[model samples]
Target: MRFSRVVEASGAVAATRSRTRKTAELGGLLDDATAEEIPTVVAWLSGVIPQGRLGVGWRSLTSLTPTPSESPSLTVAGVDDLFVRLAAAGGPGSVALRQGLLTELFGSATESEQDFLRRLMTGELRQGALAGVMVDAIAKASGQPLDLVRRAHMLTGSLPETASLAVHGGAQALAGVGLQVGRAVAPMLATPADSLADAVAALGPDLVVDFKLDGARIQVHRRDDEIAVYTRSLRDITAAVPDLVEVVRGLPCRTVILDGETLTLDADGRPRPFQDTMSRFGSSGELADDPNGLLRPFFFDCLHLDGIDLIDRPLSERLAALTTVAPGMRIPSVTNPTVAEAERHFDAALAAGHEGVMVKSLAGPYAAGRRGKAWQKVKPVHTIDLVVLGAEWGSGRRTGFLSNLHLGARDPDGGPPIMVGKTFKGLTDALLQWQTDEFGRHETHRDGHTVYLRPEIVVEIELDGVQRSSRYPGGVALRFARVVRYRPDKTVDEADTIDAIRALLP
Candidate 1:
């Protein structure tokens, strides 16, 4: 198949707001694609490389100003082979070789193909139909059930591979996907509940309320003495923390898959700061400096044990297996707690320096990577009115409009406002139009994607908390921040200060 066909399909998919249309477009493309070309289409549509990140920078991409071909001739295999060469470029004089490949690839692509390839390489493909919509497309093209494809994709953590089996081998191929001991699957996610009462009322008496700790997540796969630990994003950290490898090896079972959170505890057996846990987990060299700061795992759910795959089993059965494996290390959870009892557990978790609590259903099997009613997280978020320092031009569906606001907290020292973070979430088309009109009048300067403003617009923002960071001028950044509303009545002087944000950091 020609690479230009995939580019045209992507544009057609992005030009609509209908999921049915997006799925139909992608399904049609997949129906016409060869088996060898399916994975390339999948990766290019996702704007990611088959081998993961290619380490290509924006400067290098813009430097190769080759004139594009007038007609489309690049095949899917041709592009994939070019990516192979790009990924292989490393060590001494790799710069020129990489640039040569980049120039060659662009020189053969048409003008439209060049734009598509550049955006795809730079990860600017904001087409509304990436992974989620592609999943539906694969199911449509394969004539398979959506749930079956979703399950297979979640289990494998790779849509291209899943699509290949679904397209060529059919349902029996998807059924072959099971919980592998050493392979990492996507972790189940939770939705947000309005309150404890709402969560209890939704999941009912048959629920498990577990302490939601603020730390990095780890999925441990054990096979005798060979153990592997993967992060929530599926990156293997088996070599980073040798202590964790030892802890998993100590488990009684010869083979098991455990899903849990990893945190650093202080000498008093209390959870340490989140920064401390990240420092240990994010390290690529030697372990943490302080021995007491080593990462500790608290098992919560078991997916595989004793040669049995418990992923299709209910949470009740999974928890039972988890208790048999790591009783002492399991997260503190309650079964069918009353409103009063649930509040007490919530208070106890906060008092113990943990986050809030997670309310989960008992009868449902684990829904990997799905944020449905089966699990709901009830974390307390802090809200504050912040000043908008700037806004960036949107892309794809949001093109020609201002999006991704630069948030700032008022400096208590009476200096200029300090930038804390940027967010483009929780925005509507009406809000985007209003922001573009209002902020364009206050434009002070323009730099690439960002347009600086006069720092007069006050907007209310909600966040999980602030984290220690050097990226922002305030020495901290907001985690999971989203715009709540425009504070039209509030002035810049009334906005929350940098000191207030720092106090929220743990």
Candidate 2:
């Protein structure tokens, strides 16, 4: 396929404010892709290279190149091999290579497409197309079912792997292999309910209510004495979170993967505001010298213990196993047999300065990367899950780092993510690394220091509140908003809706 096609698609996606329209355009492009060139097509459209978690702009840059470096020397087989190396390389070297690739592609692309590619490569594209749509595009290109692709990619945390499996073995093979591998799904997410009654009505009576801590989501993988800490996006932050590494080192389990949240607390021993924890690291300025702020881990669900994968195990079983292995690291468990008791726990968490509660279904298995009614969140107000559509360039203090994020909520019926507002808070060093690398990839266009992205990543956003807005779409605005963390498991389709925003009216 010509690099022009990919550049054109990027432009189309960016021009499209609606997720459905953007998805359809990309899906059409992928559908036209040849069987032998499916991988290349997917890579170009996603602006990613197969190895590791590739960035968007880097991929776009490479697409324009007449002949970018191919993985002919890769001795290791399968999709995981490429991504693992790429993700591990999380530094300037990998970033520079990607930028070069985009430059090459943009040069080869047509005049119109070049403009689009430039925007995408610079992280300025405001299109609502997200990875969820891209997953659909990948499935269409490979002639696989959407659900099949979603399940496979979600389980492995690598879309390239899913594409390879689809082409090599077909959708059935991907499904079969996924079932045989039997890994846990990512943690389930919640669709905000109008009230507790609505949530209960949606979930019925078989739910298990757990206290939701106002902190960062963490996935801890422990192998014997070796342990790795990953954010919900699957980005490795083991080094930035040395305290978590130390705690996991003492765990009795030989090989294990657990999911939980991390938070920083004030002198009062209360979980600090989500932003306080986020502000501890990831700044280009003098953040390293700040010794007062730190993050602490609070375990929730155990995905693996020793060699056995416990994702299929019930929540009750996983919690029991978690407690037995590391009681001190375990997040406080809320076992309320009644709704009133659960409400009390929610109030108590608020009183303690924590966010709210995460209600889990005791009988459900650990759904590794999917969000469902299995877990529901209840906050006292002032938070929402938003999609990052674009970002403004930083200046002075924020020169290199992202200054502010353009946020949006889910649009029902496959519409565009409605712009709510922008934020520049709730970031740590690890968070900063992830964003810079990620935003760099999504750069559609940049003015001075700002990069724009194709609203593909969904973030858990917290803000003071919403006010009427005439400057942006959706007729509303979010004030003092910032990212809590990136929501890798979620798709733009699953983001908070305008109706949910309307509910925030004071």
Candidate 3:
């Protein structure tokens, strides 16, 4: 297949906003691909170039790159290849090559489309595009139902498997199996709930509440004595976490998959910052001598045990099976009738210095890759519903127009506006301009569309924690927060209160 075909498919996928349409188009492309060519094609399409991960990456910025005279054949390369190329072509010449590639093929694309391509190369396609969206596109192309494709994805770790299944067994084969939990399996992202009360209420009476630890979610897979620990995104960290490997190696079951979090606990047994735990993932040095460096696996859910698949099993059954394989790490359950008892558990978790707790519905089967109301999280931090007042222009591609935002909360006491923290992390270029214009129209004043807002619009904002700051009027500041979304339904007066902010402070 020609590179142009992949480019065309990319364009088609980019042009369509609907996930279903994108999935169908990608599916069609996959179906047409020859059986022998599937892996290579998948490799090419997924941009699995030689260097490692994909594309001309950030690492390329510091290194040297190939000259025009030495331009290698563009047959097919993985992410690692492009990244290395970019690294080698470190100066203006390499940048020109990347820009040339985007402009050469995707030049016909709309400005937004082109921006999307660039973002894709940079490894930040923040239009909320995910692997699942592409799965949907592949499903449509293969004439499979979207749900079937999604389920197949839960079963098979690779998109190529989904493609092969669709080509052979059709949609029916895709939907035949559900997600298997515990046996150290990967899970889809969990939707966060505000509190245990909120989670239990959403999940209902028959629920399991687990300690939401300060750690990283890990999928442990054991086949015989060999064990592999993969992060949620499937990055293998088995070698880096030697302790985890040893722990799993000692499991009772011969073959199993378990879902749990791994953390570095302080001497007092309190959870540490995520960075500390994540450091163990791929450290260049030897494992920390501290047993605290050990990845204490807490088995909350089980997908498989021995050779049997437990995807169809209820949460209760799965939990029971989970305990049999790994007893110490079993996530504790609370069956108190009232919400108040759950609150006591939440308080206990907080007292233990954990981030919060997770409440899972006991009767539901594990919904892999699904962010339904099945699991909920409760945190103590106060999330503000503020408005985007104005923005500063960003650098590089966002050279002009509003980039970072001036978010504010309406004074409940009818006082002047309170300035919260600013962030440039979440906004896409398109989102930047859209906000600029939107905030500009509601602009009380404007300096080239870096307009101040009416404070009428409200947005939900999440922060890691609150810190004391004299820089802003609220005497408190948001720590590392980005926009969740615009809460259009909320009015200025309806925003969270100062008391709420105080409650969130450390």
What is candidate 1's local distance difference test score? 0.84
Arrange candidates, best lDDT first: 1, 2, 3
* Candidate 3 ranges beyond 4 A from true positions: 20-129, 169-185, 382-506
Instruction: Give lDDT for model 3.
Output: 0.64
- Over 59-174, each residue of candidate 2 has an lDDT whose tens digit, in order, gives 44445534333322211122223334434655658776655544544344456555554443444443444567778777766778888888787777666667778878896777
User: Which of the two, 2 or 3, has more TM-score?
Assistant: 2
What stretches of model 2 exceed 4 Å from their correct place? Answer: 9-28, 31-36, 49-107, 125-129, 176-186, 197-206, 273-276, 279-294, 385-417, 421-472, 475-506
Worst 10 residues of 1 by lDDT: 485-494
Please give the lDDT score at residue 468 for candidate 1: 99
C-alpha local distance difference test of each model: 0.84, 0.65, 0.64
> lDDT score, residue 100, model 3?
57
lDDT of 3 by residue, 1-506 (tens): 43345546666765655766665666666666665444444533443332343345434322323222222223223322344554455455756786554333343443433443344454333231245665665666566787777777777766666667775778677766444432233374456576656777788788877777767788888888878887776667788888888888888888888888888888877777555776677685376887676667776877788888777688888888887988788755575346988888778888887767777888888887666677777777645667666677667888766778887755443333578667776665666776767765565566753556555667777778778888887787778987655554334545665556656787
Write the residue-wise lDDT of candidate 1 on 116-158 in tens digits: 8887786556465556788999998889888888888999988
Better of 1 and 3 by TM-score: 1
Ranking of predictions according to TM-score: 1, 2, 3
